[model samples]
Target: MNQPNTPTRVRAVLADDERLMREQLRSRLTEVWPDLDIVAEAKNGLEAVELVREHRPDLVFLDIRMPGLTGVDAARQIAQLPEDDSWLVPEIVFITAYDQYAVEAFEQGVADYVLKPAERERLLVTVQRIKKRLAQRQDGASVPDVAEPAGAPLQQLLHKLSGQLNPGAKPNYLQWIQATVGQAIQMIPVEDVLFFISDEKYTRVQTARIEALIRKPIKELVDELDPSLFWQIHRSTLVNARAIDGITRDFRGRQMVGVKSLSEKLEVSRSYTHLFKGM
Candidate 1:
């Protein structure tokens, strides 16, 4: 009698900002692909990148919009890793709620994405495709380079998003912010703001004179603010470009941004490091 050949085991990582979503995805994956081993789970994009570097999983499912670093930003950094790194670049699968990026996702042929609340049938299809690709790699067959066609569509999508956020028809940037100061409502000039940090509920507005809180989150404010005047140094942090005195390096060699006349320093994550590339 011939011995049976065991199926290949696939290692994977899942990154999502929501714990429930991660659990749901893991549960679904387990039902559809039992051989797929989920080695780790991340709650944010930064954690996702770190987990990928640590685990070197065969595949990673990243949520498109995560706090600290967006999934696209994380994927870009992973793709740019040095060739000599010990771990192979894992196949990426973006999990997003928006359908607008479908065209761009298709252009990046290397990636296979699933929409949020991943349907079992759709995930089964993705799993099959991933398995095929992995088999090809193991057989020493040439895998199509998905990264090659990714650049143009990614750039186009970014340009379109930027234009949509700040259209020429709405050239006026938000000049004043209405925030609660103690019991009274105060209107602060946008220029006076040093930075804006968002939490689950509200955004902290920091200025030279006072600190205030608002119900608006960073996502909403980004569309209203002037991109040239304000730079998104991190997913949750928006710094006034004019207020940026300089960027310094911490002991870990990570970039720390200093705002003019402000005591606090903003730590720049890997995703937004490009904004201060030349500096």
Candidate 2:
């Protein structure tokens, strides 16, 4: 008879500003995911990022808001770690108190999240999902590198949350883009931009009247553009929502967006299909 295989141990780190919250989460995780090893704990977002860099654990549970650095900011840094470090980016499960970030979280396709106080049932679901994802990755699945601009959705979510929290503070979104057209610099109103597509070196700006190129990439543009006006349909593409006429499916069932004024069709990646689910 063949011997049974032993289950692989999963390593994890828990980061929260409050000591009590960290203890409570650890206790709950122990009850739910017994195989999960708590390798380290952090008291702040900055500490959390450092811990991740040192341990490169399989998972990280981060408080959405922490002292010094926010969890979203920490995750951003962790996702952009240098490849030379040879660290596998850990799966992130944000622990949040606010319900407003839920939609944004789902839009980012995050691994999982646990509500504050850490309920056993919810943690179980998260644990199960993490296990499935880990197995898939171990089986040679083609997972995208975490340290890529594909995380722009999370950045946009963070920006929205910050604006909501500040209340009185209004973000200065880019109203116009200055692009060099031959020898003259032309100021193009952001509202007039139909879409932006980035290649290796530059981003192509398109409008009904003109097409121009800029040095700014889609990642940088995502921060400056108004989230309400633009939707990131792909890693290298951001389309003005007002310009989107409709979404259609190709012969292979891929989602494609038709622009109202432009004749070009935009291909939507599977990762961003959630943006057009209703359509």
Instruction: Specify the highest-lDDT model's number.
Output: 2
* Clashing residue pairs for model 2: none
Positional deviation of residue 160's Cα in model 1 after best superposition, in angstroms: 8.7
Q: Write the per-residue lDDT of candidate 1 for residues 43-130, one digit (tens) a residue.
A: 8878888888888887899887887777776775554333232345677788888776544565545566888889999998888767
* Predicted structure 2: lDDT: 0.75
lDDT of each: 0.72, 0.75
lDDT of 1 at 260: 86
- Tell me the TM-score of model 1: 0.51
Q: Give the range of the ten consecutive residues with the poorest summed lDDT in model 2.
A: 140-149
What total of clashing residue pairs does each candidate reach? 0, 0
lDDT of 2 by residue, 168-216 (tens): 9888999999986777779999999999998889899999888888999
What TM-score, computed on C-alpha atoms, does each candidate reach?
0.51, 0.68
By summed lDDT, the worst window of 10 consecutive residues in model 1 runs over 148-157
